[model samples]
Target chain A: MSTKELCIHLTELHAKSLLNDNDTFLFDCDGVLWNFPHIFTGAVELLNYLTEQGKRLFFVTNNSTTTQDDYAKRFNDIGYKAKPEQIICTAWLTAQHLKSINFKGKCYVLGMQSMKDELEREGFQICGGIGPDPVPSDSNAVTVDTLELEKDVDCVISAFDLHISYIKILKAATYLNRPNVLFIATNDDASHPQNDEIVKPGNYNAK
Target chain B: MSTKELCIHLTELHAKSLLNDNDTFLFDCDGVLWNFPHIFTGAVELLNYLTEQGKRLFFVTNNSTTTQDDYAKRFNDIGYKAKPEQIICTAWLTAQHLKSINFKGKCYVLGMQSMKDELEREGFQICGGIGPDPVPSDSNAVTVDTLELEKDVDCVISAFDLHISYIKILKAATYLNRPNVLFIATNDDASHPQNDEIVKPGNYNAK
Candidate 1:
């Protein structure tokens, strides 16, 4: 078939057929629902319509800097009804995954406080994510021989870390060098959109 | 030739023949001349003997934290005759390469002060290599929107950075996203030997 024939326009008839064909819908948050502070037009109405129809709706996002509860609150604040269970962000998913795997050791996180909070909510001991672990003023002072690495760290989780430092990277790398230590990254996006002219580095660049 | 025949033992006859065959010798620092603080037993003697024979010698190292002059001092401290001209370390090489390319733009470095000094010696403007660029006290305070990026950074150099931080990584990635920005990495080693029991993360791990 030609490309034109294969394309399906989302007309009112097609929308009705699509809604009837699917019992659940998954929506990405960043570009679809809203772009930061401004919610997209008609997005809340569509979500309410889906909810009224008793359809399952999930707001999935790769953003790990925000927790599931925060996302739900954001959705609610923007006139869309959302529950924590309906939000599946990376921070929540990472915690869930570790909990599912029965991870019981200390985690060294290269991420924001949101990720740490989510992991702590799952009853995991955490370190290295809350603030900056800068190298000493004397650059030569903090060498690998001088670094005090925690022996019990069993996992290194990399997400959107604004406080990522050489010391943090060193600790994570040392922990990950062990044979059994697990390495997990929330997302591998090259760049994150900030505003019109600015973009931020993602976990991929940090790695 | 057979594998066994290809191997040449450094016997008296073979040593003489090999010395006559090559007018220059390139040596690596870590495992060859010394293993930090202790010079190998015969390494200095061999270097001196080579120098007496008028054989040109170069000490090449992937270590970027030490400048050419520093390496020469290290060699002299270890009782080996050496000069700054005989050292071809990554820091020196990186500076030489940039100079060769006639690059006059400012550099955003993810490296040590040694690399910065080397670059400065070449008369290039530098930033981000001296100390820690920590995130703000509040985790949510520093976002991409608030980051003040330098507009004239035309190059990003990645080496052995003890002060590698999220702010530095963000700046490097942002600068690198431009099509004309050059990204340079000194070495891609996975790990560096610290002591008998510890291994440090290399530039590859940081990348």
Candidate 2:
């Protein structure tokens, strides 16, 4: 079938997925369809198309770990019809990985709270925030998130949080820097669209 | 006049002092007026009485280093009337001094952005924000708000910036431990008022 036919078929499947609550369509935002400034040609049309077909749409990203408030604001700023609930990050996913592995203890989270809150509900405690700052060595710290081959274990995941302050990025780097620590991340995309800027501010840059 | 009458008049005068804006009636909320949950009975009354007189009011506190916006919110939360402009803090006041004294060059800010912005505008360059969990090096930043004070410049000034966190405090105290450098604090009041909470988050406890 032609690309147009394929898109239409995907929309039909999206509608079926939403009806059955089984849709898990994760699309890379940048370069897959359009370039930076994210005011891409068919952005809204795609979302509307999916929603019309009742597809559960989620915009998974690697470079977000701030807050839902920031995410909604940024997505709106960039003309993306993204609800805070729809955007995902590696930080959020990592929180889950820790929980699935029965990781317990306070974490100094350097990322967003939504994912951290999810992890916390599963009995993980965040000692502090993890991001671009140096992670504090609180006795309660469990681990920082990264996706390295030789790192130790807990679980790894990702989500988007925007508080990319130097302290956040730097501290997460420090935890991953440890030889004994396990590291995991999400997306690991080369580039992501920020409000008006392109950011590679996540683990890949540290790598 | 008799002591009773004299006492009554002094009470009335102290009540009026709130609005006097003459000598700058200063009170430390933590220890002077009240403890953590209560206020000195006379303080609010005096403040109200002063407001009736349209006096210029200044609240100086040492315990907190939150931004003026945060302070204003705290004031509103507790039923105290405050404009962000009317509040004075050691962190704020210290930033003022640093700027006024021509603190220049890339210096690590041992305080929050509210404090950093004030100093940065005063012509000093901010090398980085002192992390919430600061390192020994992060703790010991070469910041000189005043150059002429003995030592090889780069003096550290204390403000009631609550965001200084534990590590920053350790660094500040350690930096001060050295005899060659100068350490200055903007105020010595034991605490500041925020709604009902009397915080000792400032350097009063650190001292």
Candidate 3:
């Protein structure tokens, strides 16, 4: 039988049992919970129903550009009263992973302000991720001396960024050349989805 | 059948398949990895064997008095090369939970310096957890006016502390009485273990 036909034949009791058996519900924020730029219809009602049933709700997503606070504010503005702790984004995960590993060195990053803010809040020393953009004239040549890099950097973190640059990539690559330097990416999405079109993501080539 | 008699013998192939089925292995640090001050016999050899087999390792524990960095240092000192990110203590989890929830208000904490450091590193505004001890003369009686509190606190975090005080408890309790306040505990461990002895742990009274 076709998959669609099988789904239509599922018993209501079995569906109810599936929901009743689980005390916690973990929803993927993007796509499943809501499409970007707007929340899906009945999503709010479904969340309310789960809460009324005393099921713990968690929003898990890979969108690393927004901090938990930013996500919480957006949720509230979009009519979902989500607490910050209930939202687990990749940005927070990256920070947690770094902290858990006891990384104590400076980091060269390729991402946006949200990723930077999350890492910084976790007491990570971050550079080359977000801030004033490097001018095209800043680089004299394609080749950069290894000595030119700020010393003692031991980590290179790559995340989604609209402002990713060759300079940022060069810095990240340079730091990653050291065997001791750790390299991390929030997710491995080579293309970003926007308004129903896919385009090469900025972090795609960031080492 | 007797409990021991009920055990079924497994073939070497089955044991090998079980080991080969997974790429990661998680070990509890305190009892399994190390018995307090010393590493257990064969623990190092077992870890070496796992690493040789290309298995990923993680150390999970509930000791919240130390940060990941501290734990890593101890691991290194004990001849096990461990990354800080491999350690997941309750202190780090507490901080991660608070940050994920986007808790922006001040926190009244009842924890040790490590917990305070971890939370403070996450940019939490914390007080009443670790600092100068409350003077006995400062309190005329057990009762304290609500106005005496540093207002606007919206979180009360409880973790293990070596210097827990009545003043800290009162302050944490007062902040917790607010309807909007968030209360969090690292774990439900009522007593702390040291050198094979369990003693009354800090955070025993904070609800």
Candidate 4:
């Protein structure tokens, strides 16, 4: 048959067959489940129906700005049952990846507070991501020669940061310039949808 | 002749021949003429000799941290006769490039005050390079939704900035995301020598 002929449309018969064939469901939160402040049509009903059918469900997203706990809270707020373990977000995955590699040191982050919280929950020391580290008022005051870098920063994590700065880049580059220092980016998304007209820059743009 | 056999040492005979063959010479400042705070042994003598012989010379460097005037001042301070016109640095080159293209708009700078001075001298309005634009102390106070961006930015220039921040990156990225906006980088140097042990991360690392 041709490719177009092989394509199947979603009907009641097809839906019943699909449910019977699949024991689990995976949903992407940003666009599939909801777009924040508004849930998609039948998204909640579908999740409830899936739960009633005893089908396992997992929420997957590349949002590193929020932690797994944050995702769980968001899902519950929207009337969806989501456990911390059931939400697979970039922030949680980043921490998990570090743990899997047996990394034991401080992480200099260029991301949000939630990313730091996720790493901290994984028993890692974090720096650089919480608040602004603006350039000195007198630009000449802080030269690379005078800037003090942390001695124990073993990894540099790049994620979605609203407050990325030159000082942070200098520190991250200086640390990564050393041998065996790890450079981790939570995601490489170029931009994220904010609304119909504006999109926020992602981790790739920070580079 | 093989490459090794063709290579001749810089004896007086070869030096005389080289001066006779070439009427103009170009020198790199960092490692060649001086290492900063210390001039090489015969560097000054050679420049004086070249000037006596009426050889035209140029000082070229990828350093965007200082203006051409700064370079001329450095050379004169080290007992070398250098004019601003004889010095070619990245900061000067960047401004020249913008002018050459007939660019007539504001520049968002991720560089030093000297770089800003160069652009201003070339008749361009500038922003974002002077001082500390740290993230707010309360990180939660600012989100992508609430972040304010400048509307007049037409070009994003990335140079050697010590005070690069998340806010700057956001602005640059947002500006560049527009269709007609330009992105310019002063240099692509991976690293610059500090002394013997430590190397400062250069413009390339900022990316």
Candidate 5:
């Protein structure tokens, strides 16, 4: 599908309801806020309107590769005043959600570094990944700490990765596919605008 | 199996393989290096040996959070001179591996900020997820991102999330089940050692 179709679908979201001051409005960053190659035509206007209305604008995206400051700067560079407190990207949301719900203190994340760090903040202990060594390859499954299944977990979050491979898939799917484990994502855009080209990597494998 | 059994199996890896001077020895930081509560029996020795032998000791781990520098400091605090350069964290590895494979530089990762930042360093364009939101009351189909099904994606990687509901699984599984899509994991440990307690929130969910 073209970006137009995706954008149209995304725009339809706004028609469903006008966000209230008390109710939070969640907006994905790329396709929704800033369309591929071009910022959303009405983005600044909408932000201005929201600010005037005193409504909470939450930029809850799934792209974990950036921090709120990054998004804020990008938005600012693109002519919008993106606030750190308002731009609740996936990493931010993931961290807040986990802490609010009290996710387990120790975690075995399978995501970008930010997501991992976010989890660690909620008192979760981080266990790193296995390296590319053991010759025969899949002779053995990588060993991880048995913390969640052994007890209870808050969730499992995944971020965007441009260079994901079969091994990453097998490892991530292995865990994300579990019934007891919680699964979370940053945003759900099929493609991201990169260097004037629409790049593909996130939606298919991790979504 | 039990923790001891798992440990025995990991130790058995030494016998199952040959030691190489060039083959880097990568180890996870949180659980494998130490018991989380006490100092690892030989962390200092191991680090010193790794540096002295000039063995490329790459710590390829799945913990998708903390940054390489943060990890280095943690390792250093524990008496190991771990540098961000010496670490092959999942976040960094994802980007490094993606560049090595000539990926599209677009990503759909299910991880944290560090994971995303690390991948972006390799010039990756991060994508968010898109789909219908969860039914609020349901736990099975929590959609994290709002991406479409037909978007072209190069790969998918997962890290740690403790809050994924059942609904989220349905969405990700639908995408990941496709053919030719790459999957990768930073680490596969089921959990991590938080404090005196053996906490949960590891990779068992996605296993």
Candidate 6:
């Protein structure tokens, strides 16, 4: 049989063997556990059943918009028991990855509040993410001077952001020009599901 | 050439290239950094010189008797500017390893206070370590019942313990008999440097 046919079907014995081989299970959040406003039917029951069988369950997600504390609260509010440490989101993963790579310099972030929060919680120095918007000036007669990048900025991280601007991207690009500077992105999803339609996400701005 | 002759005749140019190729350095704590009761001369100066050259440094040690916080305090007290996060001791490594392996059940530890503290900080449920010793019974009429291990214990970690007891070893052995239980040891050094003499350490008790 072709590989396409095998992908669409699974024998009962094969499924049973796959399930019995591992003591740990990892689940994704959006589109798998819950989509926006509604939780998947019987998802809670499946999680409880896994727990009853002494399986170690971890929730891994590409969603970097929500903090681990917020995710934990959402899980408990929806009648599912979860701790903050059990939710491994992309924001936390990015911080851990940077630390494991022995990053010691400040970061230039083109991201949202949760990403900044996660990095700061790990004691990383971050810059150019959130602040008051730069005031717009229409004076063209003013002399233009060469812009200098922040020498202390040595890392660039891009994630989903509702308030992304050209200024943030410029700073991130300046940092990227330096040798040995680390660059990372949380996810590369072009579009995400909404209530009734798919909408373009922050990846467009990240580019 | 003999091994002793080669060890005493290293070329200075070779040593320079070896140190210049790496941007990060990890130093061991006990014998490499300092011996007992005396800090190595000019060690602090060398660390500062490395910092001046923008080299990232970390202290890695197998000593499980001190928590990260205690180690940081010791460094600062001895006039070295070091943070707790820059030090990776066996206590912290053990906790991280358990988390990485997705351990979900309680742990039974035959170890020291630092090991228990580090595990508890990471929200691990630990049992059977660091409590008041059971009262000694001198009468021959009393009979000890069959040992009952903690049913929820699914991991056993053995480290250096000043007050090693047979009861803790029995509990560890009982947990190890169960299938799928993780067994970990911080270090297996037969002896360690004391104030003046090399004395046998806690490995025998751990076994």
| All DockQ scores | 0.53, 0.01, 0.01, 0.37, 0.02, 0.01
Ten consecutive residues with minimal summed lDDT in candidate 4 chain B? B197-206
**Candidate 2 lDDT tens digits, B10-37:** 4767855634547455544555545534
Question: What TM-score does candidate 3 get on C-alpha atoms?
Answer: 0.45
Expressed as tens digits, the lDDT of each residue in A1-207 for candidate 4 is: 896798678999999999999998888887667777768899998998998999999988988889889988988887887889998999899999999999998899988889888988989998565556666667653455676678777899888777766566667777887888898887777776555434555675343
Each model's lDDT: 0.82, 0.49, 0.70, 0.79, 0.57, 0.69
My TM-score estimates for the predictions, one after another, are 0.88, 0.35, 0.45, 0.83, 0.40, 0.45
Model 3 lDDT tens row, B136-185: 43232232223256668888877765444335555676577667889888
Off by over 4 Å in 3: A1-11, A135-148, A197-202, A205-207, B1-207
Q: In model 4, where do residues sit more than 4 Å from their true spots?
A: A1-14, A35-41, A127-130, A141-145, A196-199, A204-207, B1-9, B127-130, B140-146, B196-199, B204-207
Error of 1 at A51 (Å): 1.9
Compute the interface RMSD for candidate 6. 33.0
Location of the lowest summed lDDT over 10 successive residues in candidate 4 chain A? A198-207
Q: Candidate 3: DockQ?
A: 0.01
Candidate 4 RMSD to the real structure: 4.4
Candidate 5 has a TM-score of: 0.40
Every model's TM-score on chain B: 0.90, 0.55, 0.82, 0.89, 0.64, 0.84
lDDT of 1 by residue, B62-154 (tens): 988999999999889878869999999999999999999999898988888898889999898995545677777576645556677887888
State the displacement of the C-alpha of residue A61, model 4, in Å, after optimal TM-score superposition.
2.3
Name the regions of candidate 5 deviating beyond 4 angstroms: A1-207, B1-26, B45-57, B129-152, B177-180, B193-199, B204-207
- Misplaced by over 4 Å in model 1 are A1-9, A127-130, A205-207, B1-9, B127-129, B204-207
Error of 5 at A87 (Å): 47
- Candidate 6 local lDDT, B12-124, one digit each (tens): 98867756998998988886668744788978777777878888889999888788998888788777788899899999999999889887888887666788899999999
Better of 1 and 2 by DockQ: 1
Write candidate 2's Cα lDDT for A18-96 as tens digits. Answer: 5677555676555544554445777767766677766777766554444344555766775556686776645455655
Name the TM-score of candidate 6: 0.45
